[model samples]
Target chain A: MSEGKGGGETVELLLPATPERLALARTTGAAIASRWRFTYDEIADLRLAIDELCLTLIRPAQQEGEPRRLTLAYTLDGSSMVVRGQVDKPNPAAVNGDGQAPQPTSVSDLSERILDALVDEHGSERTDSQLSAWLRKGRSVAAP
Target chain B: MEEVFEIAEYSDDSTPVLSVRGEIDVSTAPELRDRLLGVAQDGYSTVVVDLSEVTFLDSTALGVLVSGLKRFRSAGGDLRLVVTGRNVTKVLEITGLVEVFPIFDSVSEAVST
Candidate 1:
């Protein structure tokens, strides 16, 4: 249908759960956000926020042994814009792309806490009858 | 879609408070490192990192804090952890970082000592 744009056009970008893909994610996300003419701050937020999306999906989804697919979909229009993220996992995802859920490494105390917190914040949870956890993790931005 | 990153409010005073929120990562770590260092460098003897609002953190980010803690302590300042939830504590305990930094129940307690 009509999403404020002229015709039927949707943008989709995919990135792996690796640090190497972070730059790409930010670049692509910002580009999409810019299409709607978002402000610099808005675009920056989208960049960092989308980075979290990858961390959430990658670490929690445990794609290390294999490869987890982080898919982002954004629809832009003259009036509004939308971004969506998706991943496959059960309870809080995994850590560092490893399907094996590892406790924090024995290093720094704050580091450990940070690792666990990242998991809960990024992991996908199945709702009553729908897969809505991933999308919920994404933050929206509006151009001005 | 809404953004997913968390931003912590950091304060550097006689008693520094690193108010953290959301998740911390390599991408957004400089902000945190600067805050932590700023307090420690300002000669604050007590640095309290409030993780009550911090829902998530990572190794690289944690390393940033660890180094900050060491630097703060080296400068005669002490870095204290304000535990917020079991999830974060679990990581600390599992990682055995609990032995390194002083852990407090709250920011008030962290600053008190």
Candidate 2:
């Protein structure tokens, strides 16, 4: 556990960059959201967002042919939770089904659409080496 | 923790129905994709996926559903969904897939429509 910029509680997890571990991430997110008294819908959004975040990274780590661990930083406070992560880009040759360099522009666009609809705020940055994304969800008024 | 994923097949008034319960995430989406596509390829003109009991659904699961929907529509068939719980509905709403697929309150309604 770490401290957020404003002294909020931050829970960080480092898990194998494998699809099997995605379930752990989802459950952990749900538990955190529940403990923070988020609504059912808010909790579901957190779980789904975490899933997308992990899925985006798993392929790239596998394509690298190296053991990789995904780091997830969740900053929680009374107002919101901000989730952040970074993932390496997969080898183009390994991901292409048609034997050409894989084009993932559309996938990135889809991810944006999903995060936008699910969270209060979201964005991602892509570089030659890795992709980093962040999403924030505001606490529901119904929360205790 | 054990992964809670199960897909069962049954016929509702001759319409093929896939009842999916538990989490549908990266690890389980492939199995769902296979079963749904199998049902469509088996010559069924209409397929209904019952997600009322599903505890969780992620982007991988959504992608699988989208692919299945395209397959069914191209073959002159359709994929309908029975979505009730907040877990499944929130994901669909976020992905804007609720508008893309025909949604029903129950398997009976999905099969009928």
Candidate 3:
């Protein structure tokens, strides 16, 4: 869990990068998004987005072998929340030497369309050692 | 963890209906795919997936449904969806799948059409 440097709240979770653990990730993200005053529709979008993002990391990590795990960080700042996820053991083939943000290879076209409609911003980052994906959503003004 | 997924199959006249409850993600999508395949193999010409009780579904589930639809359609059959929940309908809309699959508000409506 990474601590928030400012006054914003950040929650971090670590779970095995398996399909069975996806529900826990979605539930946790929904709880945090609810607390941050996101609308019902917004929460639903976040839940789906989190599921897609986690699965995007999990599928490749699962093929690589043991100790498959995912680290998720949810940071609530002002009217928006940012969720960042990284596989503990990244696929060797996915690591980049140029320190550029590499696209996640496992995201299906359906996942791409869903994320495009749900989140404000999303992308993946890969360095020499690790790969991560993140999404940010701003609370809808229609919420009371 | 307790079970958060369930799928039951039955018939409305000659058409088959798969009533699903709880979330459908990667973990539970295989079960769905299997059942859809089972229906197709059993020679059902039309099938309805009743997702009115479904609370959540991801792209994996969508892919499964799309595959099932393709299988049925290839054989001169069709796949229909019954989605009453806003979230589920919103997902179908987001992916523009609402235009792809025949969607209804209830099982009866889907089975009828």
In candidate 1, which residue ranges exceed 4 Å CA deviation?
A: A1-13, A16-144, B1-13
lDDT assessment of candidate 1: 0.57
Estimate, for each residue in A15-131, the C-alpha lDDT of model 2 and write its tens digit: 878888888877788788887778877887788887776666675666566776677888886589888876555454444443222225544445566777788887655555555
DockQ versus reference, model 2: 0.52
* lDDT value, residue B40 of candidate 3: 87
lDDT of residue A15 for candidate 3: 89
Cα-based lDDT at residue B22, candidate 1: 59
Cα lDDT tens digits for candidate 3, A29-138:
99988877888888889999999888778766665655677899999866788899988647567445653323333337788888889999988777545668899899
Candidate-wise lDDT, in order: 0.57, 0.77, 0.84
Interface RMSD of 1: 7.5
lDDT of 3 by residue, B1-113 (tens): 43468999999977999999998999999999999989988988789999999989899999899988889999998999999998899888988999999999889889887
Minimum summed lDDT over a 10-residue window in model 2 chain A is located at: A94-103
DockQ, all candidates in order: 0.10, 0.52, 0.59
The per-candidate count of clashes, in order, stands at: 18, 0, 0
**Which of the two, 2 or 3, has more DockQ?**
3
The sequence of per-residue lDDT tens digits that candidate 1 reaches over residues B23-113 is: 5666566678888767655677667888877654545566777887788778776778888675566556655678888988987777777
**Ranking by lDDT, best first?**
3, 2, 1
